[model samples]
Target: MTKLAINGGTPVRDTYLPYGQQWIEDDDIEEVVKALKSDYLTTGPKIKEFEEKFGKYVGVKYAVAISNGTAALHGASFAAGIKEGDEVITTPITFAASANCILYQGGKPVFADIDSSTYNIDPKDIEEKISSKTKAIVPVDFTGQPVNIDEINAIAKKYNLIVIEDGAHSLGAEYKGKRIGSLVDMTTFSFHPVKHITTGEGGMITTNNKELYEKLKLFRTHGITRDKEILYNKNESSWYYEQLELGYNYRITDIQCALGISQLNKIDKFLRRRREIAEKYNEYLKDIDGIVLPYQEEYIKSSWHLYVIQLELEKFKVGRREIFEALQAENIGVNVHYIPVYYHPYYQKLGYKKGLCPNAEKLYERIITIPLYPKMTDKDVKDVVEALDKVLKYYKR
Candidate 1:
């Protein structure tokens, strides 16, 4: 049998560190246990507490917790009044949900090129893509760096476009010193195990718009209105309710909310540790030839969700696949942040072709996400750096 490249036995430094993962603590479990023992489990007080605390933490007036990130996107899109035949502009260098939410609401997704350095949707390209059918712009905060929201907002004002920021990787990120949630019409965040915080599987949609908040609240449940004022008859008992609009069963359980509350308490620590890891990577890899480290705009503070490094293809003897395989051989777990959304088969069938977003396609050729999570220790960081050094040296022209 061929020996595995990275020694899988004899405590060989466990080489499968992934690009991102949850950092659960004992306290997180304790909180969940407390909730499990409490009176309510699904639609309980803990869920409301989580929503209020999370909304306040992000400086938003309203937050609606949902089943998962995809549901959050769907809720935001629906609340934004995205109707059939409408067009939503967004970048291709993101998870498909960023675009699929548009399709879910019977809206078309228009691909826009991304900024080469930040890997964010380019505001200029977004402006260029606008047409009569365009109703909104969903700018993804890719890899935890907030997009140029000010510029995007300015463009939106010019075109009367609603802004829905896909903030899956940017729960703790800031733009121009302001929290990301408050800067757009609607912002969606994920709580997957790999994200900065985890509530098993959960998501939140934040916005300051009262109408949007009410709409999202109704949409999160089964479109049933429990607000007594919205009822036509005051004599009706608690059993009486109204289905104001078609909605979904995206309500989050109290058990998850309990965990989220616990996780939120440690978010600052999580963000700090992630930044430390990212800074260390930047310091160690800055001098390596042909490697393009992530760039943070002066006005933005990233949550450092993933430390992605781009390779200069012309300077290397081997391609991205070769380097990735070599790292895996060395027991270093690596990943790509995304494949351009348009490259997916479903989108291709929808008339999205390869050349639509050249910059994003170019980014796809060289981007590699290295391991960077809050749980990673100093030695782990050193190990990752050493592995990269070895791989790059081995593949150098």
Candidate 2:
């Protein structure tokens, strides 16, 4: 019997399972409470504490705490000397902010096509997109899988371009035995509720460059400096500060940093559970025909922020939307990771047209993100698999 949830058969799960979620424990709550009752909420000791811990974890010499991921990208872009009339090359298969940060600094964002197999920015396509206007490359670690850093770095060096890795989906991910944050000139991370860790809302920028580190700190604080060394005018007053340059108030609070610190403590456990879930999904879904799974290279270790499955649309009676809805009907909270940045209305207003990156456009059509979070129980994983199985059985031609 071909059981079909959409055809009124029993659904696999009674309660909904979200595609991603944060794991909050009593420790997390207590940490937040401690920060709340402390003397400072913003610009407190917790901020530096969190930054130092995260920097150490990523094996980087410096890490800057920012208000959110987008701001982290913005600060990195600003520090990279991205300016008017310059062009930044980045993948189309990413959050709009990955490219938008370039626009924020009055630089143009040039689209680069992705590798068909990895769904990450292709180095060949990146090199092809380079022109005289190109000043930097922002390669996104899509779906927590690390892009080929060595190839990207080589290209960047050949052209004397800065490399800013968008590691939003790849905090704990490793490439060739090293972590994601330290390989590029700058790497950005997010701590959204659904990310590997949660500070409710927060982000980080990690780097080994001392000058970039100093600039990032200044940028996060309205370009002001209280340090006697960096300040232009010598002011002996402890309260005296100077605005060094135009910068935004992109600062993270102590409350969030406390929560982040708590979450960071359990990152290993969270990563292990996420990998376990991904492995199970691989085992269960491997036999499902007309579906293409996420590809992980043997040289890298993915944090598995998202487990996206691509449908072989030609072999399916139902399309991606239909499969998405069918799974939703069975109480699986499936979602799409992104629409190609240039396909959005704002980008269109900026005169970006379709076919900018054919592979990314095609990927946007076929990919569906399913439930793959640490909070999911064994039953939850099974339910998601069973629901997907039912949908595929009914829809596969």
Candidate 3:
């Protein structure tokens, strides 16, 4: 057998491959340049154009652009009327921002366990977490896979709670013959560099309810509105506007919107390439011992923002950290998707104890994020698989 890289043997590749990255084309740069030369940079025509196009893409009536994905979540929480004592249910196995948005509105973020197979928030756990204080459900499309939306929606309807789909990882993903944004009360997307699409740093919230749309817009722009009909001082001058409520300055720039528009134009092609890469990974990693491949449902189409794998620790002599380091030694840029949100020190200080989400905590111990982007070559995919096989086999008990 070939020697392991962790033992100072030959590595898989010379260059480091990141777990994720953005793909920028020439047209994307041209659009940004045009926006820079235009009259406005923050509140320009490009913002509206991007919003309209994004809304149409998701089959939603309205879309509000924000400074970042976290801002989008904050806007959604504000629009949902989250208050001091209200509780918003979300999964623990996600970025802190997913749950932090609830705290921003002075609401409590209730942690729900994830389904081991899909790494998504379990609908049954969501229902169990609901209480008299529950006001909204923020189910994340973890690893670009759509959560059980139909069941979550039914639960929300039964309890009269709002549904804010955290779709930061699933821009082009589909669910039950329809896109994700259209299926929830409010669905938020990210345009960070590593997301499915990039606007440098931006976010969007899509909704069918005009009321929610208006609230989202208000929250995005410091709770200010200049619309004649909604203005409290209708008889005031044309320049007059009102601050209806306290809000944040979460507006995204027009330059970024221009980039977003350009990126949006190629989302389909990018999504198709991502699916192809995922298929290749699935085929190569399926029979490998000491690993658990990601699971996908037949009915949904995943955008695959991340390609995460779970190490079968029992089959290996060393722990997860050792295997992770071994893969890195092989020049494979591997990273962990998350450590449960509640596991953070801040959450612990706020009285959130460990063991709240057993499945998420357990999964966190074995999960590692592998490279998955549109720009990756087939050789890059193969190298990643071979590196995993080598490390896992080397550490096999």
TM-score for every candidate vs. truth? 0.96, 0.98, 0.99
As a whole number from 0 to 100, the lDDT of residue 5 in candidate 3 is 82
Every candidate's lDDT? 0.91, 0.93, 0.93
Per residue, candidate 3 scores C-alpha lDDT tens digits across 65-108 of: 99999999999999999999999999998999999999999999
- Candidate 1, residues 242-322, lDDT tens digits: the string is 888899999999999999999999999999999999999999998888899999899999998888999998989989998
Query: In candidate 1, how many Å is residue 33 off?
Result: 0.6
Q: Give candidate 3's error at residue 71 in angstroms.
A: 0.2
User: Which pairs, if any, clash in model 2?
Assistant: none
Of 1 and 2, the candidate ahead on lDDT is: 2
| Weakest lDDT window of 10 consecutive positions for candidate 3 | 1-10
Q: Tens-digit lDDT track for model 2 on 2-64?
A: 565677767778887888888899989999999999999999999999999999999999999
Q: For candidate 3, what is the total of clashing residue pairs?
A: 0
Ranking by lDDT: 2, 3, 1
